[model samples]
Target: MLRKVALGSGVIALIPTISAATPVQESSKEPLKPPLMRLSELPIYEAPHAEYGEYIKSKAKAEKNSYLRSVIHPQVQAVREIAEIGIAHTESLLHTVQDNYHELRDRTEWIVQYLREEDNKEIRYGAVAMGGLTGFIFGLRGGIIRRVFYAGIGTMAMGGICFPEETKEIAKRNGALAKQYINIAYNFLYGVKPGDPQLEVKFPELSLPKNVSELTQLTINHWRVKNRSIASEKCEVECFEDLLFITILC
Candidate 1:
């Protein structure tokens, strides 16, 4: 039987509440800025040392440990079983949530962008049609007024539909990632002041299945999916250190 010291969840403890690896919603009241190219438009950053170091090292080492347990030395596994399970669970959950959200968020943003462009085209055509129809029904003078009246309303309606309100609503209703991240953020908003994410070592009796080798493969699958799909091209933090830690947890 293996017993392991639980590694503290570096992320859930040190990061911000919003570190759930999800997107943040844009406030409708906020004026539109440059178009969002990626979810990084929200506040999220990568830890310089932590990103390449413990994060990856821990994961890779765990993978190595898993392999060793299955193929080479099931005996040593008795020493560090619980910690491995917790690490895999923690990393897999965060990375999977974040990577999955990133893909969906990017796709939604692009769809909104396309619909807005299409809306502009429709407005232009509607205006042109109104002018031509009015000319056919009334004299040139009446046609001009009618064109102005009807075309103005048509354009305004299209503007309303394609502009901030529609996009904002769509982003709101469909923004599952933002909601999820926000929930995570709330937990961290107050910070690790609450204490570290529960470490498994605190309860050595708690252990994962004896057949743990398969879990390693499952976690690797999650990591690969996250790497392939999720992207965070930008982030800004009001508190650099806090935010960096938060990003790790996220």
Candidate 2:
């Protein structure tokens, strides 16, 4: 009984020691929390002028956009349409001008060709008539002096008729000759010294027959040669003359 009472006393001593160790372990495991601050201790933030400025700018931009849509858009559209119309008109006008230019060029070419052909025909007719008339005039004359004068006249007429372009040059030369003669007369009559240079009369160089008989023979031979050449070539417009003859008969 005395030994059992001693064991009970020892168990009571271990309970206090376990209670002290539990408190020390609980303190070591838990962390300490920071103290809470009051609303008055918080940081004060000031509003920036830049944010207000940006708000004002955005509001103004919206108003400007609305005004432009209402007032300026229609006018811009009208101007754009007018510009397109003007461009179209200008392009059409350019096309018309180009077409007219081409047409004018074609007409001018045709007219020039027609005039040249008519001029050639007239020259040919004039040549034939002059040659015939000169031959006839020479045949009528009798004396040597008279015959020589007629021949000279006939030769001059024939040469001028044969080449109309040369005749224009001859006319210019004749005018110069007359001016020279007048200067000479002035020098003699009024005692004025001639200042102009002397210009000689330039005649057309031709392979003409010497006499009237030879001239007539040459004309006949020329016609025969021309007829032979025409006969040798393919007759492109021979029927035109016949048609004209038929029309005249009708």
Candidate 3:
């Protein structure tokens, strides 16, 4: 009985030791907590096929391009069209202004030339008629003062008609003087310097004589020279005769 009790106590001590060792073995066997791995140490999963990754990338690119075409391209094109239209409209407006400016310049030149022509006898006749009509209208007034004014105007009209050549000479001198005064005024008011090259003075053509008799002689001499040149060129005799007739008439 004594040996049996000693053996049982020894077995009881070994049971506690085994129980402590069991917990240690169980903790160690619990996968070692994956060796305390860091996030970078972890294995990354790859696609099963390499082409599959390329296909996914390509599809994403295609979808992006499609979105650009559908959503953004139309807006860009519309903006370009609007810009082109605005440019064209601006060009058209500029052209219209240029055309109008040219037309107005031409009309002004025509009016100036018409007023400057000394041979426009209609202007003198019209002036005389206007003066006569004004005088007649004022004469109808009852006062002696108005009668005197009307009589003076009638006498001036008669003098203008009777001495038209003298009147024209006086007018030419006055017009030239007035032109100088006008130019002076224009330069003073518009900040234009004297002797500016842009303000060119146009002299009358030397070839064209102002007097009718001198102009007729010049025309006859020109025709004679031209006929001689034409005769040297073997022109027809009938044509030469016709030209001589025209020259004589001129």
Clashing pairs in 2: none
Q: Per-candidate RMSD vs. true structure?
A: 45.2, 31.5, 28.4
Evaluated at residue 47, the lDDT of candidate 2 is 34
Error of 2 at 105 (Å): 1.1
Candidate 2 ranges with C-alpha deviation above 4 Å: 1-63, 117-250
Backbone clash pairs for candidate 1 read: 2-78, 3-78, 11-249, 15-246, 17-184, 17-185, 18-185
Q: Could you give candidate 2's per-residue lDDT for residues 123-170 as a string of tens digits?
A: 655654666567557767577666666655665565555554765588
Model 1, 1-250: lDDT tens digits are: 1222233465446766754666878667422234434555544564344444656677789999888778866656754787798989999999999999999989977755764675566754454455445544554356666756665545444444456566446545645565556656666665634467722212134233345586787678879878765532222233666778889999
Can you give the lDDT of residue 42 in candidate 3? 55
Q: Write down the lDDT that model 3 would get.
A: 0.70
Show the lowest summed lDDT stretch of 10 residues, model 2: 28-37
Error of 1 at 208 (Å): 45
The model with the greatest lDDT is 3
